[model samples]
Target: MFKKSVLLYLLLAIGLVLAACGQSDQGSEDKSKEEETTQGNEEEKASEESGSESEEANDKEEDADFVAAYKEGKDELAKAGEGEEVDYQKVIDLYNNQLQPLVAERDGNIDQQISTALEAGKNGEMDGQVVKQIFDKLTQKVFYLTIKHEFQEIDENWGKKEEVNEEIAEAKEYYEVLKETVEKRDAAYETNMVDQIDAGFSEIEKAVENDDNLGFQLGKQVVDKTLMKTFYLAAGAVPNGYATKAAKEAEEDPDKAKVEQAEGWAFYQSISEYITKYAEEDAKIIEKNFNLETDVKELDPEAVNHAFVRGLSKVALHEYEESEEYWGEDKSAITALEGALFIDMIASDIKRMQGEDAYNTLNEQAQTYLDAVKSDEKEKAMEVLEKIEGTLNSIIEKAK
Candidate 1:
């Protein structure tokens, strides 16, 4: 009976071992399957990323090819000259050959349409030139459409165009009137009596207000006329000797640039006032733009030019301080500096050779001017230094 008990015990131990082995095998199999799943997911992600990269590369190549082909077509057309048409199909065929790989990569979608257009052109079965013209027209249409949308996007952009139009109109309509008014009676202007000017001085009043978009058409014409006047004014302001010389050669030889700058300022100023007056809805755009300019300071006793020029002026005035903030050390900032430190060094040398008094005076004036610029007290600083400068100028003239 004891022998039988021992054998049963042994058999039970064997059964337990077999069951444990089965569980171990199952766990191992599960681990292997999990590892395979992770590897598969990683492989799929990599494949997708690589495919996307390949697609982007192909797209870039396709765009470049298209540009090249378009340029080539243009060159060929130019060679064909005026009143002559080139073989559109021939150009299309050439472009298709260059685009084969790009189309194949895109699963032959856009490429297929291009191929069809080219083949049809080749056969001369259609006005092949029409196809090229269609594409050219589309390109121009796209550009103009983009500009139209841009004008919509920024209210300021639209205002600029509108302001330009308004100025042009005003100059053409009222410029002659003001001039004629002054011409009729120069005494009022000479005596600073601008308020006592006549309303009726120049240009014939229309007999009748015609229908058929007269206002719209007149608006455009007025803008164009204003544009011509503004052009003359701007041309006067250009410091180019060529422009100045050309003006001097003209019958009414005037400094075009100064005239133009003055006229532009007047025109823009009037437009600004008009916009502030009648264009309440549109003026909001100008206000938004005005707010966006970080450096623009609205000085109460100044005109727009002084106000407009100040934004850049202030930044320039504070550049040295701003630069210190941008770079903790001078190494980076020093590399991008754009002026002549040598000029200051030369001036220092001159002062040393002359005397302490000359150097002291130069340093004092420079320091005062720099301090004034920093303090935004330019006008006061100028008043203080004007006599000093005049004295120095006279002294130098006597020495010369």
Candidate 2:
């Protein structure tokens, strides 16, 4: 009985060993299969990402190229607007053949901008920022192309914009019409410096088209500040009835505004000669390469300065007592214009900062006062007001 029991126990031990070996082999095989499957999934994910990235890059390149073409074409159009020195006909051809076609050929770029925007989302792919960028670029391209095409048409029709035609009838200078009051004035012809201006204006426009800065300057110096001031002073002195009529017409009709402003700028340029000619050393600068036979008379730079000071002061006081309230968004533009007016005043003032138009200085001080208030300095604000009062008193004394 004892021998039989031992034999049965040995058989049972062998069967148990076999079962353990089978389980170990099954676990190893299962782990190997799982690793292979994971690797395959990783490679598929990587390929999808790379393909998406490639598509995105291609889209950006296409959009960028379209914008570039639009800009190049538009610059040519500006040259035409100033006066056609460029081959605007060629520009038109390029636009129709190149820019418009290229943009249209971008294969539904609007959809792509939208896709990119949607994919990015607002909270990290949620907002419409991407779509807006694409839309804005397209809008800009459309506008740029439209303006260029219109300008090209103008060139085709008008042949080129003309600045002044001696044959056409022109209104007389306001200064010449009212030479009595506001003393130290010279303009007498109702037709302000036409011959003096006509010769140079067209050339200046031409020089700009050719990218010749010096030539532009030579032409510019002829009528920029001096001639404009002359016209302004002349306009100020015009018979009250005509002056009111001119101002009223300026607001109602843009056509009249264009002509009047051009005439004003022309006289302003002539005025520069009054001050610059007196600085005999500057004659070389005035006569650089282009022989400007401007028979500029000598006037006290101080007188011109005073005129600019008083006139501009009135303009500023009228428009900008509280600048932020009136022109908040464009305050910087106003400040820059003020700086330019100051330069005009001082350059004209020359040696007589005292007797000259001190109005520019006082005007600057007023702007400074406005700036201080904007800065929230109440104590300094009072001081600024007092300084302005003192400056005005001094200005009044100088005028006397």
Candidate 1 lDDT by residue in tens digits, 160-185: 34333332333333333233322322
Deviation of model 1 at 307, angstroms:
39
List of clashing residue pairs for candidate 1: 168-226, 233-260, 236-256, 236-257, 237-256, 237-257, 237-258
Off by over 4 Å in 2: 1-265, 269-306, 324-374, 389-393
The lDDT per prediction is 0.32, 0.36
| Off by more than 4 A, model 1 | 1-36, 82-87, 95-133, 139-400
Give the range of the ten consecutive residues with the poorest summed lDDT in model 1: 16-25
In angstroms, give how far residue 96 of model 1 lies from its true place: 5.0
Query: What tens-digit string does per-residue lDDT give for candidate 2 at 306-349?
Result: 44444443333332343334343444333323333323333333
